[model samples]
Target: MFRPLAVVLLLVSTEPAAAAGLDAASINDAAPPSVKLPGPHQVNASVARLEIMLDRAHFSPGEIDGKLGENARKAMIAFAGANGLSFDKAVTADLWSKLAASSDGAAIVNYTIAEADVKGPFLEKLPPKMESMKDLPALGYRSPREALAEKFHMSEELLQALNPGQKFDKAGDTIAVANVLDAGNPAPVARVEVDKTRQTLSTFDAAGKLVAFYPATVGSAEKPTPSGTLKVTAINKNPTYRYNPDYKFKGVKSKRPFTIKPGPNNPVGSMWINLSAEGYGIHGTPDPAKVSKAESHGCVRLTNWDAGRVAAGLAKGTPVTFVESAR
Candidate 1:
């Protein structure tokens, strides 16, 4: 196992620049962050190990891609705040020492792919348009590779890059991968904060301790997010998305209403925490990297895992407040 002695952490803005007119289908091609980043695009062993440490601490950095991108900064900011460390400035030896003490494991590990992992219940391909998704059996992951990538908090491309010439579609295949932890089972929530300006979702426990933090795509200028507080009207898991023509979604030519079945790839991803603002909810997204860096059709969108955890922490009448960023 490769160990990192010290990491020069430059405070980079986790918020990426917004692309032009981000509709539902525009999941890939995220705009780079405005801040001058310290690291190059190449994968860094030190950075990957840092990602594992942060994830184990519960400040998820989305997919553990080796690049020190916006999601990693988000995790860093949250972790820094929780521990009373400076969110700004470089990560010195002392900071790395604290992080190293937080977790006890190798950044990478070996796991055997089970028969259930390569099961054929996966979707071969998903339609380009959300309307076309209505006719499909369900909005599941397009392939076993995608499922495995999500399971380990990795990008499909990174997974392939890490294991060249290895087929992820087989059972009983042991592979070296990131030792990422699952977003722990959700805890009870006292309050939820949806910061549209900062594009973040944070929740506080009954004692007002920050329990979770996630990058999110909030309402856009065309469809502005509602102001003030809203109550959680419903918590629907494995939710079905009903697209009404009244919403006037860009590029959606369907005048008639359509129902898209539930799965991780669904437009609303997997979980739906319905808000008091009708037709508006905090939902999940197929594109985890695009959250907080893209525009939405009048909804707050978190990464699927983050959204699931947020939903788990909330009840039928939990309060969700929309406001300015904490910074």
Candidate 2:
């Protein structure tokens, strides 16, 4: 397999936004995956950089861990398909060449925790059931760390593992974080394809180039998602969720219907890209890690950040097709 250029030096830089410098030891502590691992997800700085680049281009590879795992492979395949590369092509010199030109070199960088990051009227915790959630004023992050993690498109576990001893409450605490690309969302999306088997979604441009990809939780066995192409009919930001008992949604066993106010923790998450299918569309989730692990009732579910990016460039006539796998 071809590889992108790797950093000659294990570079460390103190990145403070409005605070003190970072600990050099903490930056150096960013390590690769243990060599004892097996399978395709081996930790590679080059792959991590690719993940960052893909994210900048709007195709998120889930968590930006430096490994060519499932999300990385899916993103590559989508890129290949969009660019007219061979469907089964492994990482080729051509791919690396293109990626290097478009991608910033490093996969990891130092970032300081901001004062605003720790400030909040945060929720103590959100109830798991939608019925219980309906009683809350608004569904939001349980902690400042959770809010910061989502902001950086990172997992809270990854953030905690990086910082070690310091409480994340203070600003100016510099930490090693995945260097996600800082570009704006991709140009308007033309269509979106959902792969049910891989549990992924790839957004394409009008010219059919890959704009972005995201891991998704499509429909379930009990209430399978519509397989045919669906048309996007609406985009609702910070949407209020109406829980109607007539639908008999699983885990939501409320006889009386309720309305859940808008927030990040809303059942449909930060945004709702409703489809013409009446009951189904691509939306955000309360749990991003479970996007592919768990099943949705019928709607396609993505992480809030990923879903918002998709929604930002989509509109009422854009096509969304559900397929078993990539062709």
Candidate 3:
């Protein structure tokens, strides 16, 4: 790994500048006290070790964004959980110590179709079609994180936790869908009902079985949840979000023509089920516990895990009836 030169190239706006270069002096002078290293520093052996562990554990940092963000934290937690290590979002010396000792290198744990059925959170069928790591470049996988997310049956958040430093090339190959059944006995089909007035999301299985229920953050009253029968028009894994300036919240200036690269910080957590109604889909949020109490721009928001499961469970063009909650 090349040692990144410490530099600070200040941008007046969020947009990328055509002529961008590192100002090592400016960055070194203004380095934040919290980071310890100067701003815009390159990946070193420490971060490299972190990245290798994360990748092996299957937390695809996508193109090694280098910045430690929420997705990375989630992956770290998952890795720690698997190892029976107590974890907090903040990085600790203990975590790094464990990371250095791990035998797994940078090799990703690829998911393949197996006879044993596995399931994802929110009821998404597991072992999503076996995709090749090589396919990532063709799929616009800008980062290894994105590529790994598509390859594994998980999200970039999981990847970020594993690797904190790396750059991703968005153009990656797509995987071939390999069928794998869920191991658990299929829960009864659900007849889901949404109540925007009450901000609730309910699911009923095929037998009208009440399998799951959750509180949701519905669209704001001003841009109320649309009223109509809808279907999940499409589903995407680790989808990139194009922020439309026209639809942005007031006082929130989006980096124009910017696409929120797919990862933990992605407004749409991981899987997105586009609805028959335009711009209205059931998706996940970076913050799940904060749902229901909050308001959405216009879509239904669930936890990232929940939304991904929902995406895996629902088929394209699945019928979804929309009606107000009796509440």
TM-score for all models, in order of appearance: 0.85, 0.80, 0.44
1-327: candidate 3 lDDT, tens digit per residue: 011122222222121111122121221122211234312323222332344355433332222223333333334544555455655433455665565455332222323333221221121121121122112222232344443444443335433433333233222322221111121222432444666665655555776644444446778865677887788778888787766666765445553544555553356767687888877888876544356657788888876645655565567666665666443
Q: In angstroms, how far off is 246's CA in candidate 2?
A: 1.9
Best by TM-score: 1
Q: Root-mean-square deviation of each candidate, in angstroms?
A: 8.5, 6.2, 15.8
lDDT tens digits, residue span 1-327, model 1: 011122244323232212122211121212222234445454444456667677766677777765677777777777766676653455545556666677666666677998877886778777889878999888988787888887787777666665666778889898767676543654689999888776778788998888767778899988888989999999999899999999888889999999998899999998899999889999998987687778999999987877877887788888899987534
Against the reference, the lDDT scores of all candidates come to: 0.72, 0.70, 0.46
Give the TM-score comparing model 2 with the true structure, all chains together.
Answer: 0.80
Q: If the candidates were sorted by their TM-score against the true structure, best first, what order would they fall in?
A: 1, 2, 3
> How does candidate 1 fare on TM-score?
0.85
How many clashing pairs does model 2 include?
Answer: 3
What's the CA RMSD of model 2 in angstroms? 6.2
Clash count list over all predictions: 1, 3, 44
Better-scoring candidate (lDDT), 1 or 3:
1
What is the Cα root-mean-square deviation between model 3 and the actual structure?
A: 15.8
Tens-place lDDT digits, model 2, residues 46-125: 44456666676566777655445666666666665555554332455565556555655454568788878787767887
